[model samples]
Target: MPDSNTKDQIIKSMLNTAFYKSAGETSLANIAEGVNIKKASIYNHFNSREHLIEETCRSCKEYIEQISFIPSDIDSVSKKYPAETVLKGIVDRYFKMHEKQPLIQIYTFIQSQKYFTPEVMDIIQAQKTALISQTEKVLLSLIQNEKINLDSNDVHSTAMWFCSAINDMLSNYLLERKKDMLPFPEKNADKMANAKSDDAAIEKINAYIEKFAELLK
Candidate 1:
């Protein structure tokens, strides 16, 4: 039987491979070579390549949830903080979560495979649904606390709009980062420019959050 450590190594290799290539390219031999084990050793933990791929996807989803800022005690937080404070706190944590390199890798891998893989698509949909639902719950909590004066009827719509706007901003920021990674002769110059760009992007996002919070008041 494969030990837990061995199983974990396999999963890590799978994630790394899938992030750089596609899930379809993550063959058993590649995973085995990554972990420095025989190709057949993988079978002790996973039934087949497909089973390993599924498990890797499951692990990625769980890892994302672990690092995400899904509040467990929304009521208490809503009661403690003002609407602006609450929204800004969430946005700050959201930015921190995206800063994680492993999270970015897993997210990119899942996004690339989502179209061809039904399970990957489901994971993407679930993440979207969860974000919107959580935002709505927070809005409802703030409404109940009399922190914000938004119409109760518009709570869900407001949550959807807020989440969509945040997502778009994040996507654009990531695209700029991707562009920075392209091969170029002036690597140092590009790095400096990208650093400045990153700072400006973050400032823009912060300003958006502040404006959004002000609008809620």
Candidate 2:
């Protein structure tokens, strides 16, 4: 087996290209070249390009988990504040996480492509299960404590919808901004006003949170 350090190096290199460089399929051969080994060497570590993509995704998830701690205020809101407060807090935290971690955004885009293969769908489902389960735990606590109105029927769906919507927003926002075309003159002022990394995340999350809140009314 290849050493752990060597595997990590390969993964690190892939992430740098995929996220920082915004590489498409063309960059794969170049990345493979950097491995300085036969193409078969990579196959020994990962089954295919998709598998490599998934590993890169897992790396991004781990990166988010490491740095995406929720605020104490938000945690407390889940216990003590209204449902709206809790929802907004959750949305805010998610947006901030996306803003800070381009790798997470990259992985999310990869995950969305799983429709092309059953294997990818399976992997994506597992990842979603883990994320939703964690989210459910928090929701459960809030519901049990009567801080939020969540119960059986739509709670899980709402949780998933929020997750999907947030990630989709991040993916699109990044893709659009990174495209080569310049903004129209009329849109330039608006774009510049909201040009900060955090702005798009905030805008998306807040808008979605409002939509989620409306569902209750």
Q: What is the lDDT of residue 207 in candidate 1?
A: 86
Local distance difference test scores for all models: 0.76, 0.57
User: What's each prediction's clash count?
Assistant: 0, 0
* Candidate 1 segments exceeding 4 Å error: 22-27, 64-76, 176-197
lDDT of 1 by residue, 105-181 (tens): 57767877787778888888788778888888889999899888899899889998999998888778866764554
Query: Would you list the clashing residue pairs of candidate 2?
Result: none
Please give the TM-score that candidate 2 achieves against the real structure: 0.61
Candidate 2, position 197, lDDT: 59
lDDT of 2: 0.57
- Candidate 2, poorest ten consecutive residues by summed lDDT: 180-189
Q: Please, what is the TM-score per model?
A: 0.78, 0.61
Residue-level lDDT of model 2, residues 91-172, one tens digit each, is: 5565545443344434544555456445556555665666575566566656666665656576788778767876577567
